[model samples]
Target: MKPVFFIAFLFFSISSIVAQPTQKPLLHGKNWMAITGKPLAATAGAAIFQKGGNAVDAACAMLAATCTMWDVLSWGGETQALIYNPKTKKVIAINAMGVAPTGATVDFFKKKGYSFPPEYGPLAATTPGTPGGICLMLANYGTKSLKEVLEPAMQLAAGYPIEAQTANSIERNKTRIKEWPYSRKTFLTRPGEKREAPEAGEIFIQKDLLTTLNKMVEAEQQALQQKKGRKDAIMAAYDRFYKGDIAQEFVRGCQEQGGLITLQDLANWKPIEEEALQTNYKGIDVYKMQSWTQGPSLLQALNILENFDLKKMGYNSSQYIHTVYQAMNLSFADRDFYYGDPYMPPVEPIKGLLSKDYAKQRAALINPNQNDPAMGPGDPYPFENKTNTYLELLKKRSFSTDSSDRQFMPTHDIRTGNSFNTSTDELYQDRLWRGTTSVEAADKDGWVVSITPSGGWLPACIAGNTGVGMSQRMQSFVLDEIINPFNVVAPGKRPRVTLTPSLALKGGKPFLSFAVQGGDTQEQNLLQFFLNMVEFDMTVQQATEAANFNSNQLWLSLGGTKMEDRKPRTGSILLNDNTKEATRSELKKMGYTLSFDDRTSGPINAIYFDWKHGSLWGGSSNHGEDYGIGW
Candidate 1:
């Protein structure tokens, strides 16, 4: 298949009306700008930019403000970031994801007579990585101090009116929130009241959370007074939570709630900064987090689909959706079967999965006439550097065995528009990342960052008066010994999380940075958006607003449950209202089950850096985490 090089001749022939629509164009500016899930967060970032902070500083500020959005993200959360540093002209990935506690072992759960590890308590909680993650960014790449970046979040946390999204999340998880006294007092309507989530526009005050943030700031100040350098002061603030009094308090809270997290787990916890997993797609250099996340799924799918004529198939056509969806299934299958923590001994090399040769082999399996509903993982072991546990154990295990009778389902409200409820095997059961949110920022100097910070909800217990909520990310780990190697429970291993923020490059320059708020759909949504930008030549705004199509057709569900029991219904494709009716009908005819919704994925926030124009264009959706501002 021939790739579509820049077809300038075709573009030159387009009519003027088609060139520029009458609708308002994207928010444009020559200065720094931001696109975030919440308006307050966006504004806070813009304010930081106005105060002469670059993209990293703005991102820290925006994320701090987003913390007030307790229903979307929390003070106790996880963060994964992909940043482009113009000074070095390099892109980096930061893994702020927490690791399973040393005490969290597969044997422990089995001996406890539980089918899977705990899903909603201290046992499920990983040490909170968000505070350390954001602080690391600020200390290394930002111009402001930790206190400055956290100012807006602190102000908002003190007293900010609750928005619709947050209020809705609060009401949905109210039952579990009431179980923890600290959580109930901090998140609910009143001290001991059982009232529902406050209505939109209702004043919501988090005095406890505010105090916690202030204490961190105070710790930073104390370090500054001790004659420490800026970076040292930031580390001091980070230590206040992980290695100091806050850590002690969290350990106590976990003990009170029957959680297994200990002081050692909190003290040893630190976010990792590593090179981003990257691939050459067409001429664009695409980047994502390593195996600890589903980020590689995007690159794998891109590699597989590169052998096809996506543009020629026509956007949103049945042929287009089928081809992309099939490729996605294959990638997700591999993700479930092979992808695992890189910290583990031997696993499939990410490079092998993203290789063009592997793509040729994987792509050759795609059938144009029909959908391969049960497509499983391919053997990438031959492409590996060493023996892979997954491949070694493959024959001994039942790759096709159906464990549907043990499907794990967490009850959540349908009106909340959560994806798990729309599926049979509980696609939402992957992790407790329902409230994840994202933010992006860029400045004229070419500093760019895409960060997704999430966690800190009430369904799980809180860390006493410290106001930090425990992360239930361990829920993504599989209890089965023979399951995917990447998701196996191991001491000090980071769970395979879905928190991915992406950055793309063109001609070795930062072209775009983006992220979204969704569990398994995060990578899927990002892949479609990236394709929209390069293949279809859609503007950032057009791509951000474009109808999204995502599929979780892979048989293996999170937590090692099989989805085969719902065959014919095992896999599902979600389409937005804007998708062509003809395409939907064609998809169904292709033997694919589908769901129609206007909002197919979480709100996507993106920033496009135009070197030619020396301008920045920010785009956000009309609803659900859509907020953008530029100077």
Candidate 2:
């Protein structure tokens, strides 16, 4: 038998031998539901739900706990949230992305003989957005007091047993943690101590963060005493955090440590209110946060898939994987070349990209037998030339370990240069980042909110304050370039992001609230998850657990000296002991790179209302402790 046929036969033979059970655990309950990446974090949200708080309230609590559990993703980071009001059946997009400081300008860096600092440095950092984002959601849609929402996290932080997941995350990022004094002090004790983790059922505490929460509560109380409305009081409290004593001290410390933030950056920052991007797939309404993040990429992927008979190709079959990968490459090519801050010029032709007519035209370009060295956005639009150029650069720059041998000497010489120019040019060009997506939705009571929060790559590594890590997201925007590119770096522009959170409504009712958190993998994962639910009729758990696949075609720009024509095609396929050899054989003949793992492909937590059962079903990913509830 041919090599391809042999592999295919093996796959089918293995699958036929053992069929995994389809029914899995599910969450079912009364009034409210919440799902998040961390179990403790989920408990924080679930606690609020039990207290009669709605999704917004739960999200606020979850955000606080998440900040403590994952210091890298903190309150200081930016956030965008989408909320759906079941009553109004309306979806609102809340853009809480941090803004570049007023003092920030490309000319300023150029004048200083610095390109862009790494993301962890003060220069790369933007105004913090979570405080503002949480306030916005509560003020507009929540019923519980700030104290009520934050108290659970405070208790958890004060002394919760460290969990294995948290411990593992700490271990994985130990090197980065050792650089910060506060983080070192908090997470690690004298070098030889046994590593600690909050066991299941143990409480973990974050005293410093708890103090911060208390201060916010006190400020809110003062504002209320002054006869402010609930929303106004919340804003007032947030102002105290950003511009009052805490802000002053925070700014001072950063300044003393060579950070670039200022009082004005904090004082003037305001979350933008933008329209949510919407599309319909398989008769289901899908909505995503727009612009700054790759929300539109989700729409674009779905548009392309609409042109293909996905079901006919069969799930996890090589043809299916290839088709999806080709679709993703096409959408990502557009993403790297066009998407950005809408306020900027040279915006990606999103409408044109999503048009059914355009999708059909683009779909016609897919080649099944061989990989396309370069995939370009289809044209009728005049901007195609510039877009293609950007695509070529991306293809040329993709990272590959094999390519390392091609330029080992040149890289050494460049690094040896004394000037910052070489370092700036090289490091700045090779960066990979993942973003956070937070969403809130309700069909009733007239409210909808969605927020995508993100921080950029490694900026300056601080010596002891893990919370103080700088963000390089600003590099995602570029001047005279597409509004949002994967690695945007433009004057006066915010970076394009992959932190899109979405809210979907069905029959004029709140249906789904979801988000995916992976750098470029975000949109593709989201697209796949949604398709698994609507098209394949998989339950939320099954949708999340199903083998996932994506193309790394657009990640070339971050490849540095290592560039390659062929990209990585990765996916998970379920095969039990019962499958036939013939089925697998045919699949291999169609061309798919493969792997097998006994875990879910992506982390996803969702609460879907099953009207027929008159209850909310919550499903959490089993991929890692990054997901699943501990309590």
Model 2 spans > 4 angstroms off? 1-24, 102-119, 168-175, 181-186, 189-205, 379-472, 475-492, 556-600, 626-631
Give the worst 10-residue stretch by lDDT in candidate 2.
408-417
What's model 2's TM-score? 0.78
Candidate 2 C-alpha lDDT tens digits along 1-631: 6868866875564454224443446666555556665666777776776677777887877776766555236666667788776556577777877766665665665566543323344555666777788887788788888878878766866777765434444544556656545555555533545554224344555555666677888998888899988888887878887888667755765565555678777787777666788988777788887766778877877888898888656565557767887888777767766666776655656667667777777778888754464565454243233344355544544433221122111110111111235344333121111124233322223333334454522222221222333354554433222322433444344566567787777777656666656555567667877776775666766666566754545632211311132122222122322224664565455443333223324455565666676666655655444333312
Best by lDDT: 1
Error of 2 at 439 (Å): 6.4
Residue-level lDDT tens digits of model 1 in 443-542 = 8888989987776654657878777777777767777755566577877888777778999999989888888766667778899988877877778877
User: Going through the candidates in order, what is the number of backbone clashes in each?
Assistant: 1, 87
Model 1 superposed RMSD (Cα): 4.9
Best by TM-score: 1
